[model samples]
Target: MSELTPLDKAEAAAKEAATDTVAVQLALAAVELAKAATAQQPAHSPACSHQHKPGRSTGEWLAIGCAVCVGGVGIAFASIAIAIGGISVAILAVVLRSLWRDYQRDVQKGR
Candidate 1:
């Protein structure tokens, strides 16, 4: 690689300084533009002046309550149905087991 002379080093430093100056000027211009844009806008817009209620209305609350009650009743009925189905399966298994035992006993007796 060729060694840089004093003149070449000075030129390189000047070029870097010019680039940094241009970047700073661009940043200041952007900041001024943002300030001017905000100055032209109203502090409180018309939409922001209106009153707002964050909570739900009475009718909405009543509807939600009714939905919860209906869901609870539906769950209770489903639980009852599942319990009845399980009991029915258990009774069937017991009856089949008793029949199988009687059949084995008869076979052993030569019936």
Candidate 2:
């Protein structure tokens, strides 16, 4: 998955807002709000649909972070060890889950 940093998010938000119609903008904003409320997250980043496009999931992100940290500490302590192999596959699982969940949620919401 492409890494989405604050800079990338801000740029995308600006670009999307520039072209959005009034109703589309409001709907997108509402979706963002709903997502934030569902996650019980603060408005760290602005709620933009572009940022919510088909992407990774929490599990995949957790796994990747764990693997990276493990690899770093392991290499530092021992000679070398790649315990977490198939990084791409694991990450793909997250992407698939995120897409399917979003689709299901949309269907339930009658969107």
Candidate 3:
């Protein structure tokens, strides 16, 4: 390759500087756009006003209480059913064991 002349070197440097300047300008424009967007928006929006009412009404509280009571009763019934099932399984096991023992005893006596 031929050696670059001073004029060519200066032109190449100018082109590189132009590209860098454009990139910096674009970054600055983005920052300005963001600032403008934030300026247009209110810090405390009127749409988020919690001025109407706070906390539950009397009827709402009553409904919540009734729901809790119903849930408790359902849980109690489920516990009772589980207990009855456990007792039934235990009784069945005991009866089966007794029958097996009697059968074995009879077989031994016959032999």
For each candidate, the alpha-carbon lDDT, in order, equals 0.95, 0.83, 0.94
Deviating ranges (above 4 Å) for candidate 3: 1-53
TM-scores for every candidate against the unseen true structure: 0.59, 0.24, 0.51
The parts of candidate 2 lying over 4 Å away from their true place are: 1-85
User: TM-score for model 2?
Assistant: 0.24
Pairs that clash in candidate 3:
none
Tens digits of lDDT, candidate 3, 17-93: 98779787898899999999999997887876566768898999999999999999999999999999999999999
Question: Each candidate: RMSD to true structure?
Answer: 8.6, 38.6, 8.5
Q: For this target, which candidate reaches the highest TM-score against the unseen true structure?
A: 1
Q: Residues 15-110, candidate 1: write the lDDT tens digits.
A: 889877978789889999999999999887786667887999899999999999999999999999999999999999999999999999999999
RMSD of 1: 8.6
* TM-score of model 1 vs. true structure: 0.59
Candidate closer to the true structure by lDDT (higher is better), 2 or 3: 3
Model 1: per-residue Cα lDDT at residue 65 = 100
